[model samples]
Target: MSVGDGRRPEPRYSRIVGELRRRIESGELAPGERVPSTREITRQWGVAMATATKVLTELRHEGLVRAVPGVGTVVSAPERATAHAPAPTAPAPTAPAPPAPAAPVRRSTPSPAAAAGSPGGLTLSRIVAAAVTVADAEGLTAVSMRRVAAELGVATMSLYRHVADKDDLLVRMMDAAIAERPLPADPPPGWRAPLDVAARQLWGLFRAHPWLAPAMSLTRPQLITSAMVYSEWVLGSLHRHGLDDQSAFTAHLTLLNYIRGLALNMETEREAEAQSGLDSEEWMDTQEPALRETLEGGRYPQLARLSRAGYDFDLDGLFEFGLQRLLDGLAVLLDEGTPPTRA
Candidate 1:
């Protein structure tokens, strides 16, 4: 904190920026070196995302870093240094550094009238499509009306012509995303087949669009037609298996939650990949040393054995395994003729 300024101490983000500046200026973080991402800054400093963002913004203002496409913000090469420090008047030659995982900042100029579909011509499909593209590429946090409008090159208020607000936009986006993958026209002729297809199909949807799983809710489910498709299939499947209304519905919920629960990781993984720019295997490779150290420590014998077993750790395989086991349990439940009604 700055003392005796007759003003409040430096804002938290400014403090964070100062620390980052020290690292960059002192050659500790070399020009073109990757710095902590907003998520990482939040974690290391125990601050909110907005604060972390502010820190990056301040650093940018000081010309301490430059944003690179597909590569996150990096320390600018010395010649390009536009910080308060004196200009060197020459570019310092350095080999290129590896790309880091900073997500794209949407910097597109609001497209000209020719490119941006007419506000008068705005359709619900176009709006939802644009919003989904934003969410899919940048995650759900990037999808505000202003951002969407910027994306579509229309005025922000123009979006209200189709959707009521952001919440309504999200609901429509979810519905549209789900509807894109329609249910199978031909049935497999039995209860288990449809359930398996529904579960796998939903999983695929979540995998394709990680933002999807969290956009939905179970308790206060959105009244969207596409969402009802899976639920109806699951409930009807169980009922066809000789389960009652309460049991069938509960079973459907459990199955949906199971898929939804696992799918939640997709978003988390999506985010980590976005911020780190590493896929699952690549990220795991980066952590191999720490993983090996823990495995060798003997504190987690079972983990060590599993690590030694050399599993591929495929999410799809895991999903299918759980689905089959769940169905097997349901098979046993059905054999019981019917579960007892509670008093």
Candidate 2:
């Protein structure tokens, strides 16, 4: 359908292409000069890579840019301007003066401040900070070496000098995020209190960076030192409660799995909200009718009764209830020398 006029409207990417064309035509970006890379376009214009790439591709198709092997894509020499060049005429007095000379291009190097802020020059800490900021604003899927470089205001190649690859960057991000959380030096008088504190701290971190949940894996765990320290703290806390090394390690694994599993759901829910533009409450409202119809059919009488009683399933409440139950089960094992329930 037509948008404003009888003719069909232009696609969004076309508008981006037009603006880029104007920049090249105005000599804001000079001929043979490097154009903004797709990565830079995405960051500066807040467009997806597909859209940004399309803009560059369109420019190439129209002979506005050509790819250079060593450098990147650069503005192409204008054909018409090269063919028909007017000899310089005397400047018109009445005409507005030409704009001031364009500023000199600045070559950005990694700053001493950035290097010093890191433990060593261009250390994992700085790399993680850049990655985390990208994940924080856009979801983790949007994070990559190219994207992180755009965020750091550096070329994509510079990021590779610090991190091996995108996966390495993500592992480092997880490590850096975990390292910020200091483990308690001494366990509380009992295992329950300290474990509870540790679990809550972890939960808070996951909630703060919702993308963190899925980044972690239980099966093939990333060998992150700080993450290992957290496990060590948990195992040591449980060691005093009459559990052997193997059992204590198992307990630590189980507890972490429980927290991570629940946190995963929270992260998924938030991601769904972001993609669909529907908040959790709005999503629940849409599902309520179908849920009520099933629940009220008498197959789930207990659940129906609870629903009718206006029960709300909150993460904090669920965590507390589950934690207490798990602790109770642990207490039973500690007192009676029985094995704890398997997860």
Candidate 3:
């Protein structure tokens, strides 16, 4: 559709990409010159973080820019063959130009921390710590080799010496974080006591690192030794309760999944707040009128009564409530001396 014809405009990222491409091609942003970071783009363009991220991605896809770890995203150096070649003719405006194939990014040599001017030099521990800090402050989506390198004041390739890749860095971060709260040296004697302690400790870990709960998985597991300590504690407690190996492991997983299920809400709520600039309470307040109208239909008496009386949806309180109920069910099973067993 024509501009005046009621067609929606091109995506915000497309426009940003075009502008940046023009700058790079015109030598305004010369080769190796830093381009706007996602945060900068958001501030300059008055756009959301996702949109800003898309702009950078589009630039990278077009081979107009590349991420340089510690230096940030920069204009890509022109290929020797194209260095003096005439500019290609613009595609007909009848339809948008097809996306150009992305060129492989060139990795710069890794520099030693001392050479990079990092005080006290870099260590694997420092790398993991910095990555965790990034994940905690921003969502997991914000963590990248380039971002972490920028955080640590070292070349992106330097991280590879300590961490094999981003996935490896994530595992190291998870292990480092879980190690912060070790299982008690002298755990309480009872099976229930130990299980309670482990669950609460895991809860605390998830609370401190919102990205953690979502990053961790029961089905597709990561090899986090500190996390294994929790598993060992939980499994041992279940075994003492007279469950067989399979049943004990299964029960341990059940309890873990329960805590992880509730913990997921923390990250989701944080992301929602960041995007909407409204916390859970404020968001709910905004929806109160709609909630009230829905309740007025009289289809859900219990919900209407609770809404009228006012209920606080506290995650911590809810976790405690659910924990006790789960323990109660396990208690009944143990008391009956008929712990669940596979047929």
Candidate 4:
């Protein structure tokens, strides 16, 4: 029977294997080039880890890829047939009108407009803008150096003049995105209002680029100058409460970590929905029956009451609640010189 005529068709892993095979055979991905990792396959193709791993394993079994100790899985030389093949022969008699010289195929280079360079040409900013546009549309997994170069209509090696590698390009994208945000020129009235405004502004930035939350590092914090300026704003706000430099810095770090952690959850939720084909509402709906059954049993009375109250548990509400409580504790310390109450 045909695929949709009754038979359930071959497994998804088989399809993945076939596509990768075609890419190798068509010379789109060259021999010795690294194959997509299991994590990459899962993210790019929206498949489970097991399915992605199975696809790679099947390719390896077919001798298409071999795992090199230091280099990871790379396309094998046996799979390089299309790369070295000669072009097909044309009919001889029909073409012989006159002994005309063949016209040269004009190769295109990266234009200064595309690369956003000065009169000299090809700056890092142009390369990063191109990369960011790709990631914004297709998600972060699509933002490779080669992909960015393709978007810029340049040789991949030409990108190296602007960016060191993919990692460098990502860092530059983060900085550029951060630079677009405008922090307060001067502090607003009181510590509460300015801090609230700053936090909300950063949160808005994450909402604009949902992928960015996970890309940032709180501990090693990418050191983007604009991001640092915002951090300084937060630190300065905390200083108004009479906290010393170290205390102020610690408070700033704590607030940043909280925001980043929550924003990462939001990013993960989006990715999970995209990959699983189940949106947040659908996922929650599936869980509701089981959750209702459990809550109705009433093993924990207080928890049951809260669940019955229909709390939506929104992230914004949670953030506001937590921030106010934290600031209240700080207020207590400021007012009475006593230890603040800890939840």
Candidate 5:
């Protein structure tokens, strides 16, 4: 509160930036040491992600920090003053000492504002592309308007010109990603053929971009035009096979759910790998002893027998088997002229 009118205080981001700057300047945060990530900053300062992002942006503008890929932001080495020092001179006893020099404005690292004005300036496509790159490399949780802006070297506020908010940006990202592998121009003859192609294409997209599977919502689906293309294609195929609107759409949804359900594991595996520094095979190897011990107790004879035979967990194989069985069941319904019952 102000003395006179009780006006609001300085922005929370500014105060947070000051505290972080103090830590960096005071050597409390050493060079090459990882600073708190945006998420951590949000928790520590009880501020929003945009505020946390601004704090780091300010630090970078002053050349106190730099972002390291896969390592978050870190304190950079202190700037040496040798290059700007005036010639050494003996001071006269009577002469008044020169007033202390002001701190030089160090804009070593380019600000996002500056980058936003450069050639091929910021656009909606660029914003979505930057966001997708970040999500693909670091998972969905790592993505935010601020983070994407940082990746594009543009002001976080500038992103609003392209997207309404984080949720809007995410929908665009999904739309763009789905658009990457468009449905084939010429559809195959039979219902199963096109359905197979569509399912496989969706799986391919999910495999390539692991974050996409979980970001997608089944309950309240976003209006992503490119994604709707797939739905339209599948529904047409199913309808041509003599199924009613509800039955065809139901079949499409069932197939989509199956593929998405399996793809959900991809992000989980990636998270586990990053956190534990072990891939699926290496992780399974580490757990072999305990797994064998539990199975050997005879609590599960079938699993024990399979364990002795060395079962290899293959997600792709499981997906294929399930897909075929589902198609077979759908084929039976189509042949017998039985409409799918609503759940």
Candidate 6:
């Protein structure tokens, strides 16, 4: 929204509406073509969810788009006969334009348009937030500088003034997402307790933001300081158990990889759901007949038995079950007082 300080800055939502309107009018987005969803609008424009909704709301009020329940918002089909009719002798008066978007907020943090050299407001927080929002909602593939800038209601080059490029921006995004939650100040007593606590915390984070698991590399993970903090927590738990440096480090990686391995499926499953328009349970139901047939073969008696019963396939259940069994074996080493290196 604009201030009364003489500048008639358009509201952020208006800017978004203008762009989408242009797309609709220019046939860039054809009739029945899906316009950006509210979530996409939020990510593409560094505006609040309400602003994104307003963008769609305005477009809809103007007869530019309409929402379809199962599908999504799409451009409204023009009335062909009326559209081709001769123009009236007198033109309709133009409605006043909305308030222009307020001057980009200059922030010390990247909230919107922070000055590059400013102490804490180094890069554009709005851009990063939009990018992260996109990755969180639609996966990393949907994020791009053009997309981010458009989301911010700014020119594409405007982002370069804040973020270096996509790679640098992605690393910054990783830091921002991972740092969303702080680790516990004090871990619970016992190596197992702390280990469980740490692993579950990471699991929840990955589950909440499925894109995160794919954002980092196992071999050459992004140097996200927030991410390393969790590693330190897990490694410290091992150190207290008298595991040597290598053993502790190895254990840390093992536990991390374990969590990440399962967490990767969260995004995969999400992508599958989006593409197929079926949730996990719905999708699994479709496969039941095939699964039963495969299991009925004489070669797999144990599988056939389990197939008769149903499974939840709960990711959390899977994580806890595997974690306990792995810890049970690790506890053996701890009880025997043998370092992993020695084993």
lDDT of 5 by residue, 1-343 (tens): 5668867778999888778777765567766676776657877889975677778777777777765322346676554212222222442122121112111111234356655786458888878877777777679989999888887687789889879999999999898888878888888997888999999999878866778999999889999999999999999988887889999988988999999999898788778767986445445556767988999889999989987765545567778888887887787878954453322
How many angstroms is residue 342 displaced in model 4 relative to the true structure, after the best TM-score fit? 17
Give per-residue CA lDDT, model 2, range 132-224, as digits (tens).
766755668888887766655566677777778988889988887777677778767778788888898787667656678889999999989
Indicate whether candidate 1 or candidate 6 has the larger TM-score. Answer: 1
Q: After superposition, how far is residue 343 of candidate 1 from its true place, in Å?
A: 39
lDDT of 4 by residue, 1-343 (tens): 3866887878889888889888865657666677786656877789976677778777777777764322345676652234333232442122112111111111134353545344346667667777766665456877798887777666788888777788888888888776766786888887867877888777766655666778898767776777888888878777777878887787777777777777776667656766875444335446767887998876978888886654444565666777777666666655644454454
Q: Model 1: per-residue lDDT, tens digit, 1-343?
A: 3587688877788889989988877668877676776656877999986687778767777888765322356787775566554455465444342112111222234354643665567778777877877887788988899988878778888778888999999999888778767787765766878888998788867765678898889888887899898778778777876889998888788888998888887777767777886544445546767898988979999989986665545466677778887877777777844343222
TM-score of candidate 4 on Cα atoms, chains taken together: 0.60
Report the lDDT of model 1 for residue 334. Answer: 76
Candidate number that wins on TM-score, 1 or 2 = 1
Query: What local distance difference test score does each model get?
Result: 0.73, 0.68, 0.73, 0.67, 0.74, 0.69
Better of 1 and 6 by lDDT: 1
Worst 10-residue stretch by lDDT in candidate 5? 97-106
Colliding residue pairs in candidate 5: none
Residue 33 of model 6, lDDT score: 72
How would you encode candidate 3's per-residue C-alpha lDDT over 42-135 as one tens digit per residue? Answer: 7789997678777876777677776432234667656411333225355211211111210111113323353356544767877777777778
Worst 10 residues of 4 by lDDT: 98-107
What's the candidate order when arranged by decreasing lDDT? 5, 1, 3, 6, 2, 4
- Report the C-alpha displacement of residue 222, candidate 5, in angstroms: 0.6
RMSD of each: 14.6, 18.4, 18.2, 17.3, 20.7, 17.7
TM-score of each predicted structure versus truth: 0.63, 0.61, 0.64, 0.60, 0.64, 0.61
lDDT of 3 at 260: 89
The 10-residue segment with the lowest total lDDT in model 2: 97-106
